[model samples]
Target: MQRIFAADIGGTNARFALFTGHEGSLGLDTVVWEKSADLRTAEDLLQIMQRQLQTPLAEGDMLVIALAGPTHGLRGKLTNGPLQVDLGGVGQRYGLSCCLLINDFTAQAFAALTPRGAGAKVVRGRALPDTESTQTKAVFGAGTGLGAASLVCCGGEAGFRHWLAVPSEAGHAPFAFVGAEEHAYQGFLARDLGCDMPTAENVLCGEGLSLLHYYLSGQFYYPAMVGEQVLSHDTPTLHWYARFLGRFCRQWILNTLSRGGLWIAGGIVAKNPQCVEHPAFLQELAAGGDVGGIVHATPILLTTDANSGLWGAARAGLEHLRGQTLAASAKG
Candidate 1:
């Protein structure tokens, strides 16, 4: 059996997995988790893997990593954290024959490409449109930070296909305010952060929720409490913030309509089930004053999964292995 290593590196934690190939199907091994602070860079990550697996690294060992940052141009800088990874340098140091660096959202998009058994719940969205060729899919995830990506699929022989991951900084795009409340929050962000430009990360992410709660309630609360408060449905502030997020999600979906449908992933959304269950979440999305009609036509949040990024990284590693084999066969 062929084996490959894959990792999903986030700001707080790094999830590593091993995939074993069997009869053209991939079986996932148990996931290994490590704190990001304990492992600073890709070199440090390799050291941890080496220690855990108790094996010597070898050439032709593929490593596919999905990082929480912009992964364009062969190098990526973390958006919310202080880590820089170079694709070429990491691969060289790890003694691996192949390495693929992908945006965390791109990894999530790969997971969204194939539906898991009874895990994915289809919410509000048009069925993926049929295309003569492969279609594109978009991914949106909110957690320690906000991340987004697009995947373009290309058809191949025998019902097989390949996918290209398009890394995007869409999360960092300027946030659009619809009404007085959001405008007020935008102003608060500007005044507090000393920057007028606020992205979706500023008002819709995990930290964003805490910030919103503080701004509204005039009380300091931990980020975890914000979720608890929202889940209890006791705080109107939390509900209002959820509506804010819904509106922003609507705008994002409309902005990336070419990608067909949007898939919301990450632990933050999954943890706060009440927010997802709130009727106002969908109402706010459909209640567009001007752009609401078009935005409402686009798909909203369907379902979220915790291990989507990890699964995506594994899938990418498998794809990378297949590509390498094909390239070697062509050369021979």
Candidate 2:
């Protein structure tokens, strides 16, 4: 029996899914989730999966795990969570054929690579189509932390679409300020968080939303509570949050030069304005100085799918299978 086992592990939660079928197309077998806090280690997570799914991982299965932090080979430490895992060992323990540990955003780039509503436009304006055979795109998610990555593609056959996925730690970089408001807020963040030169993740993630809301409204509210107001587009706090996010997006787009478009995922974006044609957020996405025109030309899309990361993990599994087949054929 053959199967694909994938996990999307973030700071707060771990989502697992099993799939059956070929690389390009996969069918879901079972999916389960566990809180990272509850699970002390990666092995604990697997045990929970076995119990919840009513199935144990078996031999010849393919495994892919996406983490919120940077990854090296099949082992790495989670930047936001407490698990330091050797994903390859997990596979070997179960007599699996292959295993991979990848950055969470790396998986996200694959989601954008797949067609069929993987992304929805959040800002008004048509994305400049990929006129060049080879083009670049950016995908970033804001959650427990800000995760970023780059994708390069030279348009061609489905199986031959030469593309590269590069992971980034852009959120840890110093935050760039566009105006006095941002500068003051930066100081406030540093003071409150007790950090020096706060990073973009400080304001772009869920916790950042709460801080931003408190800074503006002087009323403290948790990130979880801010979601409803953001969805309804009913409060100044969300407006400010949107503006701040727009600035962050512009910075990343410029940094990566993702002309193919920018696709944003995670908590905030998942609840962004209903349609790209009319986004309450990112109103000034195209408003930076000098390069303002350039930013306007870059398209921005948002995904409402709560399971986007999981979808990307599944795609990761498919690509892994695809790569193995190609390698074997070449050797033969």
Candidate 3:
């Protein structure tokens, strides 16, 4: 049996977990979440997690951290927080067998493979065809910012033989708006953002949620507060937010051609499933013009499992360990 330590480090929170067992059958042993801001000036999160662990770290255990931003090889810096991660240095400092770093959304993509992501509420389309096994699936969500990633599976009914998680910085891309009203709202966001055009993150995140509420109601409130209003009342803000999310998801689906499906994960949609459940959301998602049939055929699911990122990181760690064992066997 192999041991793995996995972390899902976001802008606001950092989650750590320990998993045991080989690839395809890992079990969670322990998990904890800490405020990322608390460790901004202190020791790195790995050290803190190590000390908090009931079972002390053992040599040869692998570590995999999923960061909230793009990664270059085994290192990445969080886009919305203060953390410059270097997996190689982490491995050296912690005396681990291997260390890996991946984009947080890529972790979500991998999570789609595990049972934790199963039984998702289908908000927009039908379930994947039974014959479908080898295809691409995508996941995106809005939180501190927007994130996206895709998973490429290769195999058949027997089961997937390989999986690849493709990370993206697509959130930074400019968002398109239709109609004069939307254009005016876009201008408002652009001016507020100090950019000529508003990116998806500027209009789809928590700040965006608050900004949208203010745009419609002329009153500023926290995301949670706005979420409460949206959940309780059928306000215009809810419809607009749902439309924007639907449009964004549609664009992502078209860009990735993820016919296998698109899974939505993030605090916004996960906490308030009604966001996607709203008719406006599906209307916008299915509004692909000539390609409406294609959009209609693609499955849409909402990921409600909060620990999905941790599970994804653990899955990644197991794959790393498997690769190492394979390499050693080939050499011997």
Candidate 4:
């Protein structure tokens, strides 16, 4: 039997859990959550994981971390978050085989495709198809960090689906500087807020929303309170956020050509479906120059799980481990 440990490390917090069993039988055990800022180093995570284990790790145990940052190869870093390190040895401390790193959105993309049914709801455009076969699909969302990934069918059992995930750092793209409002936002981040160039993440994320509201109306709200405040008080900042995100998502969705659908997932987007579905968002999405009408035709689904990084990490890890097992078997 094989055991797997999975972690979803975001800008704000990290979720950790262990799994025991194969694909269909995989279930979470000893789930733990902690603030990422509190743990300054990888060693801190290792210690917590060690204590959370119900039993000592055995030879076939594996670890997978779905990180909030853009992944470089197999390693990823949290933007203004945690220390990035090669986690290959993360399991060595427990006598496990190996560990894997994937972008948090990559993990979500996997889960977004395979629905738990309740998690996938069509929030805009047309109803989601039963399953997307040929056309590519995109999943992008904002929270502690902005995340993005593309999913397309690859191969699987007849009628079943296998997917390939293409992860991206699209949020890091410079906030589209369309007009004076956009330019002013950029200046505020660089001068008033201390952002260098101010990517889409600075304007669309939790911290960005708080700052936007403050800049627009002198009201102060933190990330935790931003969601509630935005709903309670509909302000120009919220409008800007909706339109900006509308354009941001519009471009990415068009870039991916995800006619299968465009899924918005993650803590921030999931918690506040109101923000994503605002008329401003849809209006801006359809306001694109040449491709505006094209975007309006795309299905938009607001997913509560945001790729289900915590669940995907363990399941994806199992997939990686099993692939390794098969390769080794073939060689032997």
Q: Of the candidates shown, which would achieve the greatest TM-score relative to the real structure? A: 3
Q: How displaced is residue 137 in candidate 3, in Å?
A: 0.9
Please report, in order, the local distance difference test score of every candidate based on alpha carbons: 0.68, 0.71, 0.79, 0.72
What is the full ranking by lDDT, best candidate first?
Answer: 3, 4, 2, 1
Per-residue lDDT of 1-332 in model 1, one digit per residue for the tens?
A: 66667778787877877766543455676567877765555667777876665554553367777888777655676665677776666666667777778888778877754433124554566554332335566777677777777777765543446677777777688877767876877899888767879887877777777777788788766778878764467477657766876776676666665335667776567677666567777787777563536565555444565566777776677666766777798999
Encode model 2's per-residue lDDT on 1-332: one tens digit a residue. 34777788877888888867453665677887778766556687677766776777773367778887767897777777678877656766776778878888888886675542234554544643443335587888777678888888744455446567888888888777667877898889999999988888887787888888788778777776777654355566666667667777888888888777788776666755531223435565756563646677777777666566777777777777776777798899
Q: Order the candidates by TM-score, highest first.
A: 3, 2, 1, 4
Candidate 1 vs. true structure, TM-score? 0.82
Give the least accurate 10-residue stretch of model 2, judged by summed lDDT.
273-282
Write down the TM-score for model 2: 0.83
Model 4's TM-score against the true structure: 0.80
In model 2, how large is the Cα lDDT of residue 92? 64
lDDT of 4 by residue, 1-332 (tens): 66787788877777887777554346666677777886656667666666665455553478788877656654567766765746656556667678788887787776654543225778776665546355687888887768888877666444434557787878888887678877876888878666678888888888888888888888888976878877444668777777888888789877898777787886677777777768898788777574646576677887775336777677667667656765698899
State the lDDT at 318 in candidate 4.
61
- What lDDT does model 2 reach? 0.71
In model 1, the worst 10-residue window by lDDT is 113-122
